[model samples]
Target: MSIKNTIKNWVLCSALLAALPITVTAGNKAEIGVVKDFKVTSQLASRDQAVRMFEGEFFRDPYIYLGPDDYYYLTGTRRHHLSGGSKKDWTSEGVELWRSKDLSSWELLAVPRRLGDLSWVDGLKAHSDEVGKGNARVWAPEIHFINDKWVIVHTTSVRKAMLYVADKAEGPYVETELSTTIDHKHDPSFFHDDDGKVYLTHRVDTVVEMTPDFNELTDNEFKVKPANRKMGHEGLYLTKVNDRYVIFGTAWSTDKIGRGSYNMYYATATDIRGPYSDRRYMGRFLGHGTPFQDREGQWWTTAFQNGKTMDFNTITKAKGLEKKKYTVFKDGIYLVPLELTVKSDGDVFFTPLDSRLVQPGPEEVQKF
Candidate 1:
């Protein structure tokens, strides 16, 4: 897909974000609202079947942020009331949190801060067009331990991205002074540098620095993009890999929303604000998953079921992407091992340890 077409599709996707991503036809072609009829072989389970196996853990744009005290905090866009909620419930309640010493077992924390409890409630209401009509749902909530405090940044379907801070990860959290600056950013996340500068990266390719007190933000002009093109549609995430700064973004394989597989692409640079390198394929169907390391230093990335699929053999035509590496799973969080290596030149080589997740699909638009 050309850059112009990609941008065109993005405009449509941004508006429909509060609705579940779905396709109309099911046959050989799977792009946007179109999917070729495919079969769910005995070895493969449908998306609905996969959701059942999760036992209420189903989430979208899942995040695993390792915090202080040897605990990794888990969070994402969970059902508002924890059951029977729409996947695209923009009116869903506020953030949910879980903590684990080992990723194998998780302990649900009490709701730190409900949507109504947000400190900037009145301001957010004045800003959102959906107020009183049931629309302000939270998505992609990420908590970071910065400056010895737990800071939370989340985006709502109503186009308000706000921040909250608490003394602890599980909090009676309160809104920050910066919360009033709701300028329509989505999938906002934090990157704390080694020297202690906290940067918020969002809006596809923009980054901004936060004041030490967390009360305000610098000019929102810093941008990070693949060497050649803009980063993927959304889910812009940043982390330091060794000495290199690795940034990841999510997109559909065809570079157009609703077509092909959901996937991740990444780039690396020596500087946090940088002339980054060309985009590289991270994994097919791994869009929006968070990358982190285990207690023993083994790396893994979070994966979830965002779409349904049948066996490739059932796919009469997948545009040659059927032959590419792939993995099918349900709508819950799973950690796939990562093979991360840094070269002598300081560029990072990051790929899934599982061979099935190594390449972009044939329908992928951008050539890395």
Candidate 2:
């Protein structure tokens, strides 16, 4: 099957599966199930000079966290302007890293080299007879500190996924082979559990246990059965709350145009490799959704709005099975708080606290 057809089928499967009903339970303890409605207030930060410093034409997938330097670092894909606006001009777009003390202000730290820049592509080219032509697109780059080393995982159209390591958070990274068969993988995320097990999660609802070396999977990769399988995409992050693995991700319409209007959802399981239950809608129509925990241990989600205005939404957990939810909407990167409510049949709904939030102006670039 062609990549286009495969994507179309995946989208169709997701939509069909989403119509099914899900049930919510509180860990292994509570039997009481109640449906609650919650709200979020859009904490729009002023896009003064400080905020605009992080603004750029190609900034998406804002993965923010404090680095070993005791400062926050944000990294994502960056695009280049080629002479002609042709598709071929979109070469191996590299990952860009930015640093900031506060979440609001950011500074460019490094532009890491691409996987094609490394020797791995030579191994891939060796298989070109079987896999056909190779094209690499650096996507959804994430930085994590593991075993006294800063590691990066990003997706590629050619090789699927690759792991790169560096001494520092902002990297001059070197690529190491992880998986070449997990093709079409995007939005790669890493989660280090309390039990000292590290896992990687990404698009298409797949998760795999990683070896301690963080270079390869120890077991066969498995799909995460979230309530609505079709609705999940983009970055996924895991945190253990109340002794349960809480997996959070954003679900958007498979249709590119329909994504901006979709909401975010999360699910929880007692086991990290889960028959994960209690799927709940966390928030709605938030784009490229990712979460970060503050120094106070409060969790917040950063999401962007679709269409004109391109505002940001910062939200927190408000009410429901989860303690509190919050969110905000502004241009560039935004954050929001989310609250999960359950229905009698186990369907979940995410209610945005502020509805009238403005998005950025329509992008002038032409779509492929």
Candidate 3:
């Protein structure tokens, strides 16, 4: 059968399966909703089935919240293993961005052109010899709302870390200069603490802090200690729960080379600045990551499970303080449920509730 027919059959089979309904409470109020449950089936599922339906390719580090618009924008390095060689030969497809109305259904926006796209090969080569070596390609693009505007933090092999600003999420994003400390910076994550302080986190020895405007760093800007002395090149999530700051990161140990082996881990700090302890493991054998809590209070961790599948694990509570794990069983984008427990002293623990797999409507699927 043609791929189209197979997809039609898959969709039909999926819809025919009954979904279990669950009640979701918002904050301290009573709210309820129904969701489907499914699991990834075949490796050969069409791109639409694997990604548009399953939200596979959209799994990148530093999933950032873009205001109360009920959307999270994520960006990551554009990889092209099929066209091997100097990274320069790998064209700047720029960065890929996705929009999720709910954490379950995602829409592909435009792949913004990188700074190098403004010129030709020779011109780009003149900009920096590193471009010739293919090390200057764009990597790890992150977006955040600051000073009433959306700002993007990204890296290029040539200049390392660069900043861009746009009035809208989708844009002809313009580049801006923030800092030039681009020695080993990749995974650029921006976070706004509860006290109105903005900080940038990335891999290099430890998560570093940048000036509020992201233009410069204070004397103690890079003084913050590392979360894990062993793990590097991972996502960073800063969330306030129960009035305390929580930090999440992953440790990579994949031997497959290129295929990263990362496991989800976290730590908590009384203050955003320093003195964080009580490190613990959340998800095992997960890599290239991001951990987030949805509006419905469902918590999820997105990671690459080797090169075969990108796993979205749902955290379920079996009892007090302990959590269970469920994979995105079928092939499609799913909003796994998450539960947040607030302590009287303001400490919060975000636990994964359950899995509610969602498939893209026929009209919503993108045509190649």
Candidate 4:
């Protein structure tokens, strides 16, 4: 209220104004721009950059086996750009082995021998003229650990399903001297039942009895296909759930030409060598990949959708299925989580799980 006090207050206010830019003049306003963080331009970009695992290559007919060391081992048909008019040029060399602990990150383990280099090639080629024929590439290799040794049942051509044995998962897998079991089978897969019976599914599912060493196959063989003729099947994989024998395979009718018809389907049966019924559609555009159960009992599949890393739930309803027409896109290998459920009356159904359940890793999110 005093004049001296008012003068002192005015001086203090003037000093404060000189120290700080309380008001910006027109000349300096242009210079007062934002200091943007070039590293993080947007929230979405930042989130994408946080991904750590990268998407892998096209692993067609991917067969992954859980090893004794608690690690997952994967081996598939080696793919190459086969450019030629003749099928002989389509032969691929070695099968690549990949190992991963969490299923999120994978590392290349080794490149095993080609089918042509197998020890029994001399005998097999002598017995069957088709052994060294066109496009006789090793295809759809399915690996399994049986009776203390590793066994790989694979197809050399559309005509031969041969067996290879090894002492280790990551192996120098040697071909057994035995002859081809199913000469006209493609994508041969072995399934060990809870009842301790190991059944191999080649084109038409067959119950095969292996020797104690798992190298030799006995004459114990039975047919499981005529049970369901409607199933124009390919990529057969037999899995036993509870008291049911479930065969998950692919059935695609390319009736609409360009609108490619490749879809994964499944059939169920009470007996292994069954009258397997209830042929149902699983997902469209899924390539010849196998269904596997994780450590936590979660069902998932690693298949290709247009060559990309494509995976979806085995039991979850497939998303974006409303599109009447479907074309197989060359997307890389995709790994998806699936939910498989069975009804009280013994019916089984699968739905592809929510996409939100899987997040892109660093390999997927490119960082500059």
For all predicted structures, in order, the TM-scores are: 0.80, 0.66, 0.61, 0.67
Write down the worst ten-residue block by lDDT for model 4. 1-10
Per-residue lDDT tens digits for candidate 4, residues 47-101, read 2211112233333566667777778776775343121113223323345566776
**Candidate 2: lDDT over CA atoms?**
0.50
- The whole-model lDDT of each prediction reads 0.66, 0.50, 0.44, 0.52
Clash numbers, per candidate: 11, 43, 18, 32
What tens-digit string does per-residue lDDT give for candidate 3 at 14-129? 24322211111123111112122223323212212222233332223334353556676645553431123243333333565667554443455655545434424344445445
Best by lDDT: 1
Q: How many backbone clashes are present in model 4?
A: 32
Candidate 1, run of 10 with poorest lDDT? 23-32
Tell me model 4's lDDT, rounded to 2 decimals. Answer: 0.52
Higher-TM-score candidate of 1 and 2: 1
Q: Model 2 over residues 266-287: C-alpha lDDT tens digits? A: 6766676676765555554455
Report the candidate with higher lDDT, 1 versus 4: 1
How well is each residue in 1-368 modelled by candidate 1, as lDDT tens digits? 00001345435544655542111112211111221122223312121122122344456767777776888777787653343345544434557777765554566664566556665666556555443233466778888888888988888765677788889888778778788774567788888888978788786787888897678887755888888887778888888876888888887786656666778888888887888999888887788888877666656677776556546444334555433433365655656667778787878877786555676666678765
Candidate number achieving the greatest TM-score relative to the actual structure:
1
